[model samples]
Target: MTPLRQRHLTTAILLTLSCTIAIAKTPVATGTGGAVATISEEASRAALTILNRGGNAVDAAVAAAATLGVTDPFSCGVGGGGFMVLYLAKDKRVITIDHRETAPMSFQPAVFLDNGKEMDFETVVASGMSVGVPGTVRGWHEALQRYGTMSFRDVLAPAIGVADKGFTVSENFTHLVDQNTAKFSRFPATAALYLRNGKAIRAGTLLRNPDLARTYQTLARGGVKAFYQGPLARAIVDAVNRPATAPGMTVRGGAMTLADLANYEARIRQPVHSTYRGYDLYGMPLPSSGGVAVFEALNILEGWDLKSLPRDRAEHLYLEASRLAFADRNAYLADPEYVDAPIAGLLSKGYAAQRRALVDETRAASGPVAAGDPYPFQQDASVPLRPAAVKLQQEGAHTTHLTVSDKDGNIVSYTFTIESWGGSGIVVPGHGFLLNNEMTDFDFTGPQPNVPEAGKRPRSSMAPTIALKDGKPAFSIGSPGGATIITTVLQTIVNYVDLGMRMDQAVDAPRLSERNGTATDIEPGFATGAQAGTLARYGQRWSDAPEEIGAANALVFNPDGTVTAVSEGHRHGIGSALVQKSAH
Candidate 1:
């Protein structure tokens, strides 16, 4: 359900304006031919339109992601970057693409420090120091060049149309806008685009971005180089270094040279591979902690017969496993270019067994738990053991996700984001897009795994996963919630694979996020469930989440060869799940 703060207005005019959009934001669809699932109906339509035009899953994914830049601007756009996990049907191989944002080459570890003291987080978030060089446009270019069946112009047409013609703003958009009013109002470009007379637009208002459409057209005409090497690049750099602030509003500028943009490239990386109950799973590799952390936790849980256990007992184990995995993740994982993550050791079942031994089913472990040593399992006993404890860091919950599949069995699971709502709060003048605040994702304090460095990608928790049952596509799932993303994906897979719940049931089930914290964050449904009291007796402390944990989209391949696409029934204003044709 939409949060109480986002309750829709009861007025004939507003309802009519919202209904006029024509596309229904249906939360679930199971059908034949092809399928697309995302948080917005406009984006779903964009993907379906591509599928109908003979584009492959890779093409459809790019289309949906671009459309989301228009419909869900607060979360993602060309101004951001992300990870993509794709399955090529013809090749029968699952590969991952890493297009995550990178720190500028001139960036230093002490960027957020003053007189050896860390700056206030809120101030740093809106300054130029927070911006990361974006990798989205190049990432899309790579995906299309590698596997797509259509031209960039063809896939981009849908998003351009959506941007030129507006969609009715929903309660979710209004809520996000209201939440970021102070930030948005600081810049003339951002303010003029989102606000009306210096105020947030109401739900059902028509929101258009001709500037973004024109920007898309520019890319269509000049190609990716136009964005990375020319006027667009200059405009982006100017916006970062000399932020356009409202009179009397002061914000720090950042140092981002055109060299940073031109030097950017999306790389093809090996997917993080593991197995559960005979199912082969693939996830995005480092720079992203999602795949490794999920694997470690699942390996720990695999020791138990969760299917036969009672609900409370099983959930207690789930929380403990997540806590332990996060402890390891915080201490060890970061940008692979800068740190040699112990990939071999972290995913080893023997290491998981060691971690699992510490979990007492009867009582929750006190946190922050010390990160375990996996060097022995890595067969590199000479490597020094890691520091015992690490601080818990939280990332922006403002990211977007989508999943797509073609009739040919190709699939793409993607998650992308601008660092925070309104990002650095500066929009590129003439061209329209937010610059990412992703630099702030790094640790401000010293001697940590995720501290910022030149050309290093910050650690991310986006786990876009594809699983194989008998070496065929079984399911593709992902979500958008900072650190909670790992737990959401892990818990959903557990719900479907271990608990035997339907795909939709797994997506809808109440969420609990345990990141080696003193208390796990729980959704209202979980806190109110009958088993909540029983779990508490096991020493599982609960803290109600301010908003739902994750907005997720998924698809399951059935035994009969049909695909089931599922989205949240209510979270983030009812996500859209659609297929090329209805099952009935």
Candidate 2:
């Protein structure tokens, strides 16, 4: 071996040894029946229960997701929308579902702007105008009808039970409620649902939402029609249009009509596919840029010997790759129905090669790099490439993710959101669920592909992903963290596959994210003296704050038919396995 190759081999060996020794051993929940991982323990348990009861992965996913809506209401609910990535083991095929929220047909691009100026930040967040026509309920119904073996009523039972019987408020729930007291107080129904005696309910307080339970029950009994066309739909519209009168403001409400709700539909789109180190990666496609971005970053990193590099250098490379990927993400990714995103070009190995050539190993790219031209690599030149435009919109970290797998080999990775905590702070009067401020996901200020438009789904960062090894399902993973979701998933895959970390260690490892920015945000433990200095040489400004990067959950399907599931403990996530007990 050459001197350089030998040196790299030695360094890799040493680094691996150090990392193995440094990482604290964490237990991996394993079982033969199935596995469930999620942000809430109750949700994980609900999924496991479904798996043990002969439910398929799809059924368990729906049950777990529904439970999360009840247990983690501040993050996601029936009033929101999300995406799901599923692997049908029987068919050996992958499916992606896009239930992302859409702008009302009456909505205009300037809705969030006043007289050509941006509206007050508070108004944009708390007002009815921020609400989008919700699609979560419809999405759930579609998943059950198409892929699930169980009925909608059966899948929703756990969520309904939780909502009706009530659950103890978790510390996270209490903290979020306390933080949003001002906004929640603006809406009487919201305050009544979450607060008591003008104070945020403390942790351990038994909180129940009978109205939400009734809504879920109505859907269970009447199906999707109950939510999209019946009383619940009307209640949503009226509540969104109801004017708010605060002490110093009278914010006008939304223009969501019954037609908007009636016309809402969840679509089954093609999953974005790529290969990294012989592993086939599948992610949700647009209106989510996550899959494309992750693929792009992976494609770029494929050219490097990450294992040969020192840990800090490896991290620097990751940051640079993410920056390049996000630059393209900001410019091109959007709702494919409304915008001509260059899917073929973006995922092409040739295009990735071109983008990879632009990376500087010794220094970071100065300033924000403009999106590259990916159209030249497209096979079909019939559709002209739209000019790229930069879109800057604030996104929150409030969201939930769940992953489930069954002994049948089926797998599900799902991520859902309401845009922000207590989304729009508008509870549909008597419904007890928060409406999504998903409209804020659009770029109102920029003339971009993701600009708000009638009948257009907002661009999203919800990426539910699955990876396969040697033509068998290996991992089902996803996370909840707005734009950071892509980077989080990418890092976990890198940690597990490239760095040779165990499944639990991969999910628990410290993470860093750089979303086309000069500053690289690192979790506290990962940013320190020598490593920080090495990254600084690459022109990376460090932000050591514990940025809520993402709460990722993953399930590793072993070749022997057993499954290992892991949840990021730092985020208070939980994992459970449906182990079959040998006859006692």
Candidate 3:
């Protein structure tokens, strides 16, 4: 059988198993007036445990996040980085916290460039210097201090127990290890933990990280400072500076200095704000183009009454909005600390009007069109990337997002990543986790746009988002795909409000993304093949393969009094559960 056909067979088997398992598990309580948390089952149970102990959503969120740090260590942990968007029901306030990692003050932009030329992907993607000052712990600690009702130590208990007693490695963890074995072999400490007897640990095997538990203990006793300035930091410095750590590339680890770790801090910033179709949308600020791009795409598509339009017209709207927003993303968006990112201008009606003018009623634009003025159009002129015209296929894997809402109406949506797999695979001994290779998130060489800069935040695709309808929190959504983060979140909201899909249907629905110039949908063999075919009738280039659609986890609250939640069926390791307000 052809490779595509073989994948279809594998997909069919997985889908059948998912359905069977979903049915076998008892349906959790769901609906109005109760709390709901959507995340991995292990994490969900931990949150529910907190709720049962009288913890609010903030408390439950802290619990779930800590549990994820232990069980899903490959994708996210205290060693990595993340961001959060929160909605408070009591006063009806929306707030965002930016805990994105920062480039160390000692970090040099030209460090990734060798002799004035951009380094190859291998050099840029893997190195100790590629590590950013981690911010996930500090970010979460600050959020809890300001908003949480439960003691921070109490929230961390579940994670400590899981780590100390050990937990089974999930299928997802196994896949990540397989994909990055080369990097794991380069770092002795990383290999010792993730690889057993010199081989990747098999799925379902119980894995323990005594070192990570020790790190968590330090934070629990001394706050986030312990990781940055205490023994943990010293141990990290020692491991990174060791002569054996760097691969035989042009660069080495002498760059990660002690002062860099001692001075690291995660910044807190205001969220990007906009109103779309009478609903308020709030998301991560600069360093994350998700907020502006999603808002722009939604605003552009708002002019069209998609509910009454045919499939083709709806698809046309999706493509046009993507093209405009993406052009803006590439040319202008960056760390506001480093660039004068025109957040206000990009989301302005004036900018939308200018972009709207470029959308033709029929036929795709012959080539990419740049968003004018603040974002001048640039013709891509490098070696022909096969899926030319559109943005490069952002590697699509290894991210996880969780959204939690409690009876008190406090809601939190958080997104996390270790970049790709075991990250750069250069673990600091005694730290027990991989550092993010987020340096690759920036352009290494350019006309100076999106290039790496010391202390500048790298652009991110994670878009943990929330919407307010009638002045009340209505939905929380996000996804796990390298660059498809914004598109997935935008599509989920559109599916819920525009298409009137329930949470499950919305998440399982087909998706399409366009940026720069190309448009892509879930491969034809995807469960939503019909949706892709229907979209193709408009303008998108639908691939017959099966890897293009993103995996989503989402939740929606209805005015009619129901809380609906869903996890993507195709996500081999994902599961969603809800504990509604009115559940018996």
Best candidate (score: lDDT): 1
lDDT of each: 0.88, 0.81, 0.69
Please, what are the lDDT tens digits per residue for candidate 2 over residues 72-161?
A: 888899889999999999999999889999999987777778889988766787988888899998898888889888766667777777
lDDT of 1 by residue, 1-584 (tens): 23331222112212332343465568889988889899998888888877876779999999899999999988899998999999999999999899999999888888789999999888888888889999999999999989997656767777887888788898889898899999988889999988888888999998889999999988766778989998899999999999989999999998899999999999899999999999999999999999999999999999999999987889899999999999999999999988888989999999999999999988888666888988889898575657658778858877888999999999999999997887887888888788889988898887887998999899999999999999899999999998999999999999999999998889988888999988998877676667778888998888755468889999888888788889888899999998887887
- What TM-score would you give candidate 1 relative to the actual structure? 0.95
How far does residue 544 in candidate 3 sit from its true spot (Å)?
A: 8.2
Which regions of candidate 2 are displaced past 4 Å?
Answer: 1-27, 243-249, 382-391, 524-530, 573-584
Model 3 has a clash total of 5
| Candidate that would win on TM-score | 1
- Sorted on TM-score, best first, the list reads 1, 2, 3
Question: What is the overall TM-score of model 3 with all chains considered together?
Answer: 0.87
lDDT of 1 at 147: 90
lDDT minimum window of 10 residues, candidate 2:
16-25
Q: How accurate is candidate 1 locally (lDDT)?
A: 0.88
Can you tell me which runs of candidate 1 are displaced by over 4 Å? 1-23, 525-529
Better by lDDT, candidate 2 or 1:
1
Look at candidate 1 and tell me the lDDT of residue 269.
96
